[model samples]
Target: MNQHLRRLAFACTLFYTAAFASASQEKAKAPDAPAATRSRTLVIEPFMRVTNSSPTVVELQIALRKFTAPGGKGPAVWLSAVSHIGETNYYGALQKHLDAQALVLFEGVQARASTNAPAPEAARGAPTKEPAATQPAAPAKAAAPPDKSAKQTSIQHTLAESLGLVFQLEAIDYKRATFRNSDLSIQELQKIMEGDPDDPADASPAKKNEQLDRLVKVMDGSSFVGKMFAGVIQIIGTSPRLQGLTRLALIETLGQIRGDITQMNGLPPDMQTLMKVLIVERNRAVMKDLKSELEKAEPAKSISIFYGAGHMEDFERRLRRELKLEPGETLWLPAFSVDLQKAGLSKFETEMIRGMVKKQMEVILP
Candidate 1:
């Protein structure tokens, strides 16, 4: 049972990490050190990472990168990779940064009926010549019925509470005028996953949905394993020692995985397909919106794409290939960090937990 629980924890951790990667900044004064004397910072990877700043302190950081068209003639684009859950101030800082942009293309899948079809003017990716004051406001549509599949407990919210952090939706204000939805409707995603009826090459929708449902149950704390996982999360939440140990374990596990989307090749076919849809197909939607915006007669001077870290790599590629954009500056935001000593873990205990996590990763990843 103990071994089973351990495996379950690892599985749950990996899934959420990937899914959310498929979903912060401390203002620190720079030291007055000479450039040559300063320690070299680690090269930024594609999206998320786990870094150890000290022997006892570890952090999980997400990336925000800038890209621009050739000769810097067009509007600059920013790819802000975010976690589904993070420190309060991190989101606050992120919000401040995004508020500076003329437009923000964000990710949020809604029901088909609830999704607002882009206006004909916006569809053409051009600003209407009519004055803003002359344009009538859109009527508020009735809310779509709640999705049954989404009734399950939110794993991201639960994990946020357990870790004393905040969920992204609760922390970031998405209602701003600058924000625009650039994701598929939930029904559209489901249809794609369901596969085409006439194409035998497509995987069976029933089989795929069944597999997806099982995974959702596990993630949302509905299944037996999920209950056990929630119990573990609760225990970790209540005990500082457990929190510290769990943080260490997570750091080790995430360190090995490194938020590389390719690492998901080891997962089951259904899961791989799910991720492909979640990251790739949705990315196509975002790029479509991006191209539309760029085609506008007077496009926003600056635009930002706020999406799960897992999707950034594909977005980067699209920006480079389709838009002919060049990568520019990058910023690392600390999402979650923990001090082993402060959390009541000794040096030996930290090392021990890390060793255990490494062994589990060996089995899981191998």
Candidate 2:
């Protein structure tokens, strides 16, 4: 296998899984003040990413409609981070709680299939066109065609259906946002690796070839480590006893994302550069799109941006410093539950595990 291609694949696997992963702080309650005096909520939460095989955990989220603006009844906005894969029950629940006219905006949305494309002739053809003999003696009734309008259901669309809300289809296209493509290009990367004293960014074919060879060697060595780490993270995130501790670990790991490439032990500098490009630059781009959406939104509307927990710190700071939006409430939703009954742990053992989690959190935070 080409080392460069293998490295790209490995990095993408890790990025897809970790992209939606987030950490949560202890849950907090909304104020008990009257609706007339209540401030609109800007929810900040961490979420654990899930797949079909993983145990379903609580999805930490903020529904802006929950914080109604006083004397201002209208739709709220939900800005989300995850890409649209398929339909799920979670979006259904969210739709039930939002305003009828609310809007849900998602980040990194793909360019939609063209609406103007010619409709299929088969769709318009009569079902009973064939002759009686040509069709079987007792022709089976053809099944109803699937609804094309509802085919591409992202979290936004699913929620929109129940909420009677509209979606502002303005997210960046998925092609431009992938792990390898979103970051610095290979040629640019080669220039950085081959720094010059007079012209630090000077590029040459020899230097490019040299850098490519080095990258190939480095990727071959690190592929196993990357895969192993990704598997370990997923396991810890789903296990009953270690899930909480895993949150703390993820927070610590993502927190150091801004550090220099030299600090990334074991991984090649090129790989480290790609990781930074994937996490940092991509997040900033998401934030920029979100800011644009917010500006276009109507004033006094309650709006929420549902993103990964690691992003909350930077986003919150930006909102406060640049946009003047302050968080009014924050909460935690458990991604999954530990069933002691299923695990068959003694009460003493359960207490011991809880104590250990608390201790680990204390050490990891502050």
Best by TM-score: 1
Model 2: worst 10 consecutive residues (lDDT sum): 174-183
In candidate 1, stretches whose alpha carbon ends up further than 4 angstroms from where it belongs are 1-12, 18-44, 110-152, 196-202, 213-228, 258-266, 356-366
Candidate 2 lDDT by residue in tens digits, 99-218: 232332222211111232112222111121334565556544421222234323322232222222222222222111111111122344344445533222443446544645443333
lDDT of 1 at 102: 87
Q: TM-score of every model? A: 0.76, 0.39
Model 2 vs. true fold: TM: 0.39
lDDT of each: 0.63, 0.33
- Listing every candidate in turn, what is its Cα RMSD in Å to the true structure after a full C-alpha superposition? 9.1, 16.0
lDDT of 1 by residue, 1-366 (tens): 434444444554664554444331101112244565345433335566788878868888888999997888989999998877778988998998888998887765532224444332232212212246744585333222223344236566666777677877778876666776666664566676776343245568876666656655665678887677666665546655555555566656665653344344466655655655555556666677788788989988999988776567656756765566888998988887889779876777666666777776665542
